[model samples]
Target chain A: MRYFTTTVDLKDSELDHSIYVQCLQLRREVFISQMGWNLYQHMGCEFDQYDTPASVHVVALQNNAVLGCMRLLRTDNDLGNATYMILDAHLGRIPNLPSGIMDEQIQSQDTWEASRLAISSRVPTSERNAVLVDLLRTGMEYVATRGGTSLLGMMNPVFLRVFRRAGLRAYKFGRIADQRDGRLCVMKLDLEPGAAMVAA
Target chain B: MKHPIQEKFNKYGFVILAPGQVPSDAITTFSDEWKEVYFRNEFHKIDPVFEFAVRSTRNSNCTLLSEAQMTNELFEEARMFEADSNFVSVSHYGGNTMVFGGVNPELDPRATASIQHACQATHRIELLKNLDLLTDTQIDLMEMAEEGFLDKEIASEFGISLSAIAQRKQAICKAVGTDCFKSTLRLYTLQKWGGLVGEYT
Candidate 1:
């Protein structure tokens, strides 16, 4: 019931490693065992390569139990950029991708493009919604503080519904494809500076 | 025309018209219109029988189940062969009980009333306990507010007049000691959940 917002690294040492394992276990329970999502099962862990150096990990816990977790990757990362490029193939045409929160840090010389986000399904519904609200607020605040123009990403249609409910305008990208988890539609949200700042 | 079937529907939530008992033309026309809307919205996954149950019981002032209502039975049969099918196959009869009566079956009036009362009592109790920051009437008003029900709707639902409902709502707000309705609701929810606000780890 106690709530604390700290970066993943800050909680890393104090965190119960067993909770992390349970988080992964819960992910497997929902995604692999139940829904039969084939993408992460081969990874040995519920995590993927985008989880490495450039991702900001957020965790929600209650009484030392990791209830939920999400990963935010800077668009400049190798795996992160690849998401947008691959989306272009599904889209059948490329469109101008917007800059993400870490554009300045990642694309100091070149133009930055899109942020990648991955959210875990361990959290309860209400808490999950709250976490997403906080995520959008924090991301926008970070962009505003750094004088960034906008933010963009490729995300699943389900999560896109959440974003739209939170008052963000999202455009569906790419043709719907049948994944192991039913049909998925790619989507993008353009976070305007003023609006993003207010949201933050 | 004062149809006996319509009177039965008004008294009870549902009615069943036997085959050739009611005019099929009206039902067919209604069904066709509903199908257009359902398929247009990509809600074809919904079982047709269940749809008929809802439409006949909730929407229509008439109660009837025909042989064509057996389409839901076929849908169930078809879904059983699918690999990832967890369709809600049976009709829910309030609380957690599932009734086997699909197209046509005897209805239990007492069981239905008992279920309805139990659900209302449960909802009222939970709402009162959760809204500790507000009075019972205030909690009721808050629920109505959340639902965006009009004053008349709220009054009719609670068996009170429009003016009485508004006065009670205002008084409840005063008792809650908060000018902002949303903040009061949030605080009440927080208190109900052990007063741990925004403390997600």
Candidate 2:
């Protein structure tokens, strides 16, 4: 099953211990152990500043195992001031973004950013593919329900091609140079509210 | 390909397709080759990932298929694409399916929703691409309309008359084939004019 849990919605004390722990384990396996991303290297589970109060985590699970996960942060929350998108968090300066990249004023409330996308490598090969799609389904369903109109985040090149191929009205925002993960670029996926893609 | 998108597939190990290309029989793999799979092999119907992806379009909620679906031969073949590492993202919009995923190392679910929204919006744009949906002034006005800008607020932001705004909106709706400009905005919240170049600036 797939659903969302936010620091705002579910208290840390009330967390489903098994699922939450699995999320941390999955992060460790995907980000640290497998990918060698040092930033996520922690005491067997990866946690960061972005996992603050009011942060949303969309998780997918099957057969009692954590399938995949991602995090969404609402800038309107108090912690939002603590950590914004790649702009304030990594880049330190917002790009002279194209007009619809999102208004500086409106982004605070209506726009939320996604990060920490990870999938466990331990699942059996046959089930791995289906689990990945489950994660996306859960995450987007969460955003749509929250009244989100756009997603602003950073991605590397390989997945960027996937988004374009997937038909996301994805556009270039800017580039993040001098990062450990090569050069990361800014991307935006604009949403159409209540408009479904009908075959012409 | 754009840096961010490629990195997502590399980092997360998955990709999604636009609505127009979903139905194509060609499936891409981590090695960047489009393999010709007979899509009618019935695996898509029984595959939980495929079913959940299609269900994601109709409802704004994520649907998780039962664990039993992983045992199917078709999904088994797809999983074996990259040695059981990455899977493709197959998303549907309106009625069209944009089937893409199974690239990189391991596909993550967090990218799915963002990918689906992006795919649908971009697909919507492609459908309206020929219509010249927005004039220069109209585009400017629409940007103002974002972030809860009302007609009055947009008019004030653009320093234009409300009637002018109304007329511009009418033209946009007429051009884009939406019932009204509001609906067009709901479906085609476009930021870039050029269709998915898949490259970094």
Candidate 3:
């Protein structure tokens, strides 16, 4: 099987074309057309404004055809902050979990932040999940490189479980509420290096 | 003589050549070369598909089976793959059995109902027809529709200020005559596009 990967810096206008359009279409087809998520109203085609300049896009290809894609946004900016605030109110309060000596290493770091993530269903589950893991790891690494101590986000519980199982210190923040789809969890993960950050 | 299969394998990650297409001598040569490269392993499967357990690792725990089995497994798993005409078909497990190929649309009933309720509550369709009155550029700006992209992303994608996207969206709401942007537009669009004849007619 032939495989290829490309990172699309949303900052680059060269990649803003039909390929991105197709990716948006797939997102709509899965998240809207089929699933009936009313989150986005259809334009002439599937798209929305969040595909802006700061978003980092990654696409996977097989035999020259796009198989899957994802977008990552750095949350350093005011509006680009993580989903924690929206979810924090609903989730109530963050729980205190047991931490190891590694927690000290993380707490010593100065800054902590998070990001927003969106993924397409076009890629196979295995490949897509692997890509997600890679993206998360990359994001965490990027934060570490910047001397940040932690990463946080409002993630679906299922994904939170994946993060926890991978040895990341994923915690639920705020109060839990029954969403239309079920309970939504405000998840946080500390990214400082140490045994505690290692997957169990 | 070297087999053509070996030569193809060297060039392509995998191949599915039709039977009797290559000369016997070339096949032998290719097969020998393939064994050398692949350590005597035959290309038993070419991009075989597999349905995995929900919690399985992305790299492991998938069962390789025939296409039919894969489809059946996916059905059993309640997962869907998008089906496209141009997709190549292959199975994972050993055997020659074949089944439907391509990705099937996975629908979440709850999500659908949520969308329907939101659409009905808001009237989405009526808003779209009025979209023409907006500038061509404004119309082009509407494509980044996913909720995840947020306001800032919308602004950058359209090369407009965030305030501009918000204002245009507000204009869209006023044009469609609804207060809620998402729900109203969806319901309006659905009702407008439902019948055999166009809603405008």
State residue A74's C-alpha deviation in candidate 3, in Å. Answer: 3.7
TM-score of candidate 3 on Cα atoms, chains taken together: 0.36
Error of 3 at A183 (Å): 2.1
**TM-score, per-candidate, Cα-based:** 0.39, 0.41, 0.36
* TM-score of the A chain in model 3: 0.60
Residue B76 miss distance in model 2 (angstroms): 60
For candidate 1, what is the TM-score? Answer: 0.39
Calculate the i-RMS of every candidate, to one decimal place.
15.2, 15.2, 20.0
Q: Ten-residue segment with the worst summed lDDT in candidate 1 chain B? A: B93-102
- Model 1 residue B58 CA deviation in Å: 18
**Candidate 1 segments exceeding 4 Å error:** A9-26, A40-44, A79-127, A139-161, A174-180, A192-200, B1-201
**Best-fitting candidate, measured by TM-score?**
2
lDDT of 1 at A109: 13
Better of 1 and 2 by lDDT: 2
lDDT of 1 by residue, B1-201 (tens): 122222112121111222212212211112344434434644433544345444433221212334354355443443342211111112221111111111213334334444334323332232333243444455555545543567798789789898897677655544543334455544443322221112222
